[model samples]
Target: MDQSFLLMLSNLLHLHNHLDPTSALLSDAHSPTSTSSSSTSSSLLTSSSDAQWRSSYGLSYPVFTTVVDKLKPYIAQSNLSLPSDYAVAMVLSRLTHGLSSKTLASRYSLEPYLISKITNMVTRLLATKLYPEFIKIPVSRRRLHETTQAFEELTSLPNMCGAIDSSPVKLHRLPSDYNPSTYRSRYGYPAVQLQVVADHKKIFWDVCVKGPGGIDDAAHLRDSLLYNRLTSGDVVWDKVINVRGHHVRPFIVGDWCYPLLSFLLTPFTWDRTGSPAQNEFDAALMKGRTVVEEAIGLLKGRWKILQDLNVGLNHAPQTIVACCVLHNLCQIAREPEPELWKEPEESGPPPRVVESEKSLYYIGDNLRHALADDLYQRLSR
Candidate 1:
């Protein structure tokens, strides 16, 4: 293992001592019980009670087992000394509780190095092996219909398929080669950026982590593969509705920090400077945008590791992506929501239109105006 990785592990182990005493005590008390209960189960997989499993892993026992079953072949191929289920559970525990390798090693009676290896391997599998199955755009007719219908109910925005946002994942320590300034987020922390698009159910359909914390949200978004696909017309949503003669297609809602595009719509004016109809449209669009914000909160809240991401720089993206995958799994399973992780308030000027996208921008502008007028007229009656 790299010395920087070990150093980060050491720093995290030390920081773990400063967490809430009550939570630490509760975790310590129940962790052994969770272990013993799993040993008695037929597959030696999960805690006896759903509550116990959720407390330990932020998911129900059935979902935990489902994850294990899904990853079993991949984990088995790794030839891990521990059973595939046990390895998955162990890694989930670390991700859930933000436990350090030393702490986890002590709990499971394994060497710290082995614990680190298991964490990396399992997270890699979750991020890559399971990502395609869990996180994907709603392209199918049924899925798209369901998603758009749900959002229409929430925001009264026709053909709205998802909401988009980005959050900074703070790093516990910077890498040796990194310039501190380059890693510093607007929140004044060294971090990485995680951008996601989520449906009205708070389930993620798209996840991207391609830049350092210093990168602006709009810039990071433009650099994403999703942006390329959308710009190139490679990704298509067939559902379209005519509002005031504008053929409104399936689209996502975002805040002013992201550029306004034909498929990605932002508010008309962030400060209510627009006309009454425009203001109403902005309110409705914002209501839709809250889904992505809530999704990010649930992600960080359930996967506590994201609160203070301690992984090495190279592994940070995979760690964040794995948490997104797990978030989708939990959402699909209808797991109880945790306390929301409140982010710092966002404030910034709207993004400038991309030079090459001016035509699309004009189209989106006309579409927004038409929708606003149509929505205003409908509400007036």
Candidate 2:
């Protein structure tokens, strides 16, 4: 176990001692009555209405139960005193409401240590056990067609499969041995960088947490598994369309912060000084990019823990990835969305081209010009 994690637990325990547990427990509107025990926790799991369940657990009762059922076997193996449903609910409550373990301990009438233990267990399961099932690339032909069609309708850009972007997940506290400078984000906070590829409906298909927040988006992306897979020709999207005599394969769009490649496209210029066709293509690409931005917003909005990620450094990546899995689940289940969490305006110089990728970059450049001309002609018609 990390010393910082142990220190964090000690601090929470000390904070718990100063807190009025009874009053704190009662203050939570979603908390069960004062006499409530594990039985009450179980009852609440089965009884809460959809709205109430969403308020307390960030998803409707049905979705909550779906999650509980899926993880029940693994969670039951933990040998917790509470029922599987209750334990999952308690952890979701913490994730949904951004409540500390001490606060959750008061609400659930359990030791703070128990709360932390359960949180780690459940989040780890979600990030690892359930991740591959929930978050996946649209490899199936039908799913791929649906995604590309939706993106085409949304942005009028042909063969756009997904939009990629990166955001900083802020860390509330840094480990003692870590230098703050390496983790300091452009937003002036210690954080880890999370890169994701969101489809038309803002469902994340790829997620990577590889570097500190201070790492620029381009560098972080270069370190990702998705980058390798795409560059190495391992992830081949079968759908291809010819635009102005150029064979345009399914590609993802990003802002200027990312490099342009045959499989990944970025804006030609941020200043809009190019030809009318180039400007139109840039606008359309940005429209497609909005889906990923909204996806990140919805992620943080629903899982409040992401807004000020309080988990330890070692566990931060898993926690963020867990929230992403939950986000995809909720999106798939068609749960009601909360207000979006807006990020500050982003500004950065264009990324430098990679020497090894120059050949691929030339191909991408030709494709962009051809696609722009094609799109401009069609729109004119």
Candidate 3:
């Protein structure tokens, strides 16, 4: 047998002998029934009994010692005025356990005020340090090409760009109209929504939060910084269309909700009986768009905090934003494969059906034919 196991057995035996398991004396001393004399006796028994318990199950002093040593830097920089690692551990434990601050204090032997500070400090650090690594614009063409290739390999979709969508994190309904509309439920609950643009690699390039719940995807796009990127003249592509003759090529892709701008790719809609060509085109388009769906699944899977977060009014929206950033961090740290995209019980609508007969608005036959020709030419070569 292990030496440690034998030591634990001995300690258990000592506690069993010193502490009376069946007697009510331990409980009575802390109760109101105890007089001053009995209280003193109870306190002595409790102290000695606790010491024995520690000797049996408690972590070794060197364990805490090593953790504290490694935590000194995080502690020194923290504004909490307490040690950093202690604060971080306290916050993590609370988040993991979902315990009230008072409960955490009693369990962890920490001050309640210090617990709050630790949570806030660690959250802010995670947002600042970890977020940018996985959620930023790809500035270089080489990186963009790498991303494009990855998407093509994963989904067999050509000229692979990115996946885009808006996900609403539900919030508690408030009384005021302003607060009420901020929580929309096209799904099931009121929420503060964040627009996410993630690429094939499951990295979020741009994340915009704080759009109103009552607003549609188009309205959100109108007010987003992402819209500015679309309209920006700096991002140039040579082979794509020229709606306004801008330098920017139409390399980026969005779904139907996006505007028919010069540099974006959307699906082709077929009228009347769905042509084989159109079905193939639509399948290809959905193939690329599905990356975002899979990415979102992986994101929610890893950071379960996103699935059940209910932040206070002051930090509700920001917390959602922070969660998105952390989601990206986890994605970057551990890139899971296609299995991450497994179907949830409650998924969105069935695949779009613009049958051969329906007259859809953007189902421009001439334009689609032209676009299809161009794509075929490039892809064939």
Clashing pairs in 1: none
Better of 2 and 3 by TM-score: 2
For each candidate in the order shown, give its overall lDDT on alpha carbons.
0.83, 0.83, 0.50
Give the root-mean-square deviation of each candidate in angstroms.
6.2, 6.1, 13.0
lDDT of 1 by residue, 9-117 (tens): 3333233233211222113222323333234245233214677678777888899889988988888788554456556766787899888787765654457987788
> TM-score for each prediction?
0.88, 0.88, 0.62
lDDT of 3 by residue, 65-136 (tens): 333444455656655443343344344333322445565456534456655555566666555554565467
For all candidates, the clash counts are 0, 0, 8
Between prediction 2 and prediction 3, the one with superior lDDT is: 2
- lDDT, candidate 2, 94-213, per-residue tens: 799888776656753557887788889999999999999999988889999999999999888889999999999999899989999999999999999999999988999999999999
Ranking by lDDT: 2, 1, 3
Among residues 3 or more apart in sequence or in different chains, the pairs in candidate 3 whose N, CA or C atoms overlap within 3 Å are 75-84, 183-191, 237-249, 250-263, 271-356, 272-356, 272-357, 273-356
TM-score of 2: 0.88
